[model samples]
Structures are given as C-alpha cells and as structure tokens.
Target: MSNAADLRAKSTDQLNEQLLDLKKEQFNLRFQKASGQLENTARVRQVRREIASVKTILGERSRTA
Candidate 1:
C-alpha cells in the first residue's frame, strides 16, 4: 500500500479523484470476494487504508484552510 504522506501530497481535487477511483476498486474487490474470484484478500485492507489516508488528508486540509 502507498503511504498516507505520499497520498496527502496531491491537490484536493486530485485527492477526490483518487478517492473515487479507490472506492470503485474497493467495490470490485468486494464483488470478487463474493464471487470467490478474489486471489489476494490483502487488497481489501489496502483499499481500506487508502480510504483512510484520503480522509485524513481531507480532514487536515479542512483544518488548515
């Protein structure tokens, strides 16, 4: 998984786009799990961590500006 500090370096709009993309990926991962097609279960954790990273960035930005 990519680090939160790296993810937080992007602009707000970029962050939003990334967050959206990640959510889509997370959905797909969940679908795969349901279908018994998922090979890497750790992916779900990675997606979750990324979501948390995005939210952390958003929160920090809001408090600063």
Candidate 2:
C-alpha cells in the first residue's frame, strides 16, 4: 500500500493511470471471487482503498489548481 506522501509525489497523469489499473483489478477480483478462484480476499479491500486514495489525491490537485 502506498502512503499519502508517495501518492502526492506522482504526477496527475500517473495517478490517473494507476486509478484505472486499480479499477480493472477490482473488476477482475470480483469475478475471481464469484468463480471461487480468489485466494487473496484482502486484496479486494486494498484495491478499493487505493482507488479511493487516488481519487482523493486527484481531487486535492484539482481543488488546488
């Protein structure tokens, strides 16, 4: 998990790409859970929080700009 400081250091475009990747992983995790193929259940929550963090950082940048 990346901390706020690390996320803040990233450019907005990099953050956006990261957010998109996390969203895709979230979707795949959901499918894996449904198919009973998911072993790392905790990852779902981690990804969710990561997505939120990226969005929060993006929002902060937009507000500041």
Candidate 3:
C-alpha cells in the first residue's frame, strides 16, 4: 500500500503503470477467490482501496494540470 504523499510525488506515467499493475492484481485476486485458493482475504480490500487512492490522486493531478 502506498501513501497519498508518495503517490502524489510520482510522475503521471508511473502512476498509470501502478494502476495497471493494481488492476491486474485485482483480477488475479478475484480469480483466486472464485477458485477457493485465496489465503489472505483482506488483500482484496487492500487492493481495492489502493486502486481508489491511485485513481483519486490521478484525478487531482489531472484537474490541476
């Protein structure tokens, strides 16, 4: 999980990359849950929140620019 300040400091390209990676992870987590192979159930919530945070930060940057 990344802090807001840290995320805000990164370039747009980096944030986009991170967002892509998070989406991929989210998909995998969902797959695991469906297959009953998910160990850390809490990770799904964590990833969702992180995805939201990254998106929020990206929105802020876009509005300011």
Candidate 4:
C-alpha cells in the first residue's frame, strides 16, 4: 500500500480511479462475508482504511483545487 504522501501526490483522476477500485474490492469483501467465505475478517478493516485513504486524498485535492 502506498503512503499518505504517495496518495496525495496522485492527480484527482488517479485518486478517483483508485477510489473506484477500492469500492469494488469493498463490495466483493462484503459479498464474501455474506457468503461465509471470508477467511480473514481483518481484511474488512484494512479495506475500510484503504477507502478512507482514497477519500482523504480526494477531499484534500478538491479543497486545494
């Protein structure tokens, strides 16, 4: 995973793309949880953090723009 600085350095478009990917992964994780096939429950927390990271970068970029 990239650091906050690396994330912040990404352009808005890149951040958006990353956010979309993260969201898709989050959805898959949720589906696995529902199906009782999720092996690592900790993945939920990690993905949540990744989502938040992308959001933070996007929000910061928007404010600056």
Candidate topping lDDT: 2
Q: TM-scores, in order shown?
A: 0.90, 0.97, 0.97, 0.89
Q: Candidate 1 or 2, higher TM-score?
A: 2
Model 3 per-residue lDDT tens digits across residues 6-49 = 99899999999999999999999999999999999999999999
lDDT of 4: 0.87
Instruction: For candidate 2, write residues 1-65 as lDDT tens digits.
Output: 99999999999999999999999999999999999999999999999999999999999999999
Decoy 2 TM-score against native: 0.97
Please give the CA lDDT of all the candidate structures.
Answer: 0.91, 0.98, 0.96, 0.87
TM-score of 3: 0.97
Clash count for each candidate, listed in order shown: 0, 0, 0, 0
Error (Å) of candidate 3 at residue 2 is 0.7
Residue pairs clashing in model 4 are: none
Predict model 2's lDDT versus the native. 0.98
Worst 10 residues of 1 by lDDT: 1-10
Where does candidate 3 stray beyond 4 Å? none
For model 4, state the Cα shift of residue 64 in Å: 1.5
Residue clash pairs of candidate 1: none
Off by over 4 Å in 1: none
